[model samples]
Target: MFSLRARDAMSASWAVSLLSKSLTGFSFWIVGTGAASAHVKWFCAYDAAGQPRGLENVLCRDFELLLGVALLWFFSGCVVERTSLGELLVRSINRVTEGLRLHTEVMIRAVCGFFFISLWAVGGIILTPELKTTSPQVGLLQLAIAAGLLSRRTMPFSAAGIVVLFGLAVRDYGTFHLADYPIFLGLAAYLALTGLQKDLFGVPPLDVVRYATAVTLMWASVEKWAYPEWSFPLLIEHPGITLGFDNEFYMRAAGMVEFTLAFALAWTPLVRRVAAAMLLGMFISACFEFGWLDVIGHSGIIVVLVAILADDRPREAEYRAPWLAPAGLCAALTVTLFTYYVGHAAMFNTSIL
Candidate 1:
């Protein structure tokens, strides 16, 4: 059960099962920790039956210190090259990146996924209060843990991992609004589908990542339709303000368009470009409505968009570029305000009340 065979069909099945078990174990640990943290201080007794046996506390602290040290060692190597610490590092990365094999790419994704999972774990520990009170969110946490474990070779797992991480981070920062979850879910779907598919000469193998993205986009569209409040007003909002929709019909029409496009994105890869474009529009609109200026999160999605574009490169093209990754990101930041007023027409209209 522990062995990984390169050829056997059972191997995939077994791996998924084991991965599920591992995820469940981590989920239970997180839930238990969250529950315990709610009542007691970090180093104090967790229950009436338990004593202030500082041994467990000390051991946990020591373990954390060691883990930090080990992570630094591994990450520093990824950052630093052998002889060149300046321009050479950039050139070296670019040169080597031109020929990255599928396995190597998967490994890189796994490393990134692990880093994200670690962040979620730490964040959850800190945000125990919010999680303890709102139990449904724990399902998202569990889903993330499971996805991280299953990300071995499948795109679905990768999608799950990315979405779960986003979910955890959003919740930690107190962004539990319903609209935000779907956006994050959409992003997670994009990441998972694109991350696993390393080869894209033609119609790239529609694996888990693609499937996940399709599911999320379609589901989100369905949800938006079901909850007109989240979709309608924003569609016909004022250009630069959060004034909400003056006309209900305009908002509803906009919702229909968003819903339709989201579904279209699922059925065909060509629609991904359209989806990316729409999302970019929405991001820009968001900036106008609320000067959030959270470039980090915003840029992350843009990176994925750029990655998708890069992946769609033609085989005949000469010297394909990877810098498009950062270019899309910078461009998105500049245009983020465009998406701000999407539902602006509905923001301040109290007449409906």
Candidate 2:
């Protein structure tokens, strides 16, 4: 009987050890994949106009499985939003963030100032790492944008400068490349509208930003499905990131995770706040691996996320119909994928199949 008990204890210990290792590997997978969120174009060779993988190739069994999982996760969150527990979470968060919420706009302005200054300091970079230029004038424009952010009165000018810079980037990089960053346009609109003490018709400027952020992330996630090969080089260089998973599978999982989290940003208050916090953490974690470029490139979005987290506004309407969120997620996935594939085909005159 003593020997039998000893054998059972050994078996239980082995199982626990295995479970611990599995959990550790899963954490590393998430962190490593999140760290790669730094634009792959920065670390890998990519042609914005090149033909992407066909939809048939991208919509594999693995992709479908992940999509189903993401849908379930989103639906679960929505269902939670209607619960008293969600409200309690929201209230707790609001209480903690009350001070921050009041100064959210100020925080954004300060961060934007720092971001533009960093761009000026770096020089030759057009908005992000991949969008490089040798023009000295662009650096000066960045400085000017930073200066404009000094005052609310001149913030509109700063916003206009951001739009101008985005246009320049689009002209140089093409719309397909620029589509990865609709958040810039969203920021510009937010800055301009907020500076002028106005909202987009009836919608708040920050809400416009939320929608744009969702669109940007959803669109970029599709890129992972369409161009997972673009990140192959990075995976080869940093194999540890895969945590022993196949590169293709890892990329598919990353894309699905990003898409689901992005969709959550426009969800009910508790859900969105949690999504914002997770994204912010992911971006920050990436910065540890990619360094200053990652920090500067992602600063704008990071600040926007902070503001989202700090936002304590009531959103009872969102929880009223919890079922709609999963349906919306499905619709959003279809539309974004369709738009990306068809738009790329039209722009590059390439076959999308």
Judging by TM-score against the true structure, name the best candidate: 2
lDDT of each: 0.36, 0.83
Q: Residue 331 of model 2: what lDDT?
A: 87
* Highest-scoring model, lDDT: 2
Candidate 2 wrong stretches, greater than 4 Å: 1-32
TM-score of each candidate structure, all chains considered together: 0.35, 0.89
Worst 10 residues of 1 by lDDT: 32-41
* Off by more than 4 A, model 1: 1-207, 230-247, 267-271, 287-303, 313-353
- lDDT of candidate 2 over 233-276, digit per residue (tens): 87887787776778887788788778888888887788889888
Per-residue lDDT over 185-265 for candidate 1, one digit per residue giving the tens place of the 0 to 100 score: 544544454646543444343323333343333333322222324332333333322122133222222333333333333
* Model 1, position 62: C-alpha lDDT score: 27
TM-score, candidate 2, is 0.89
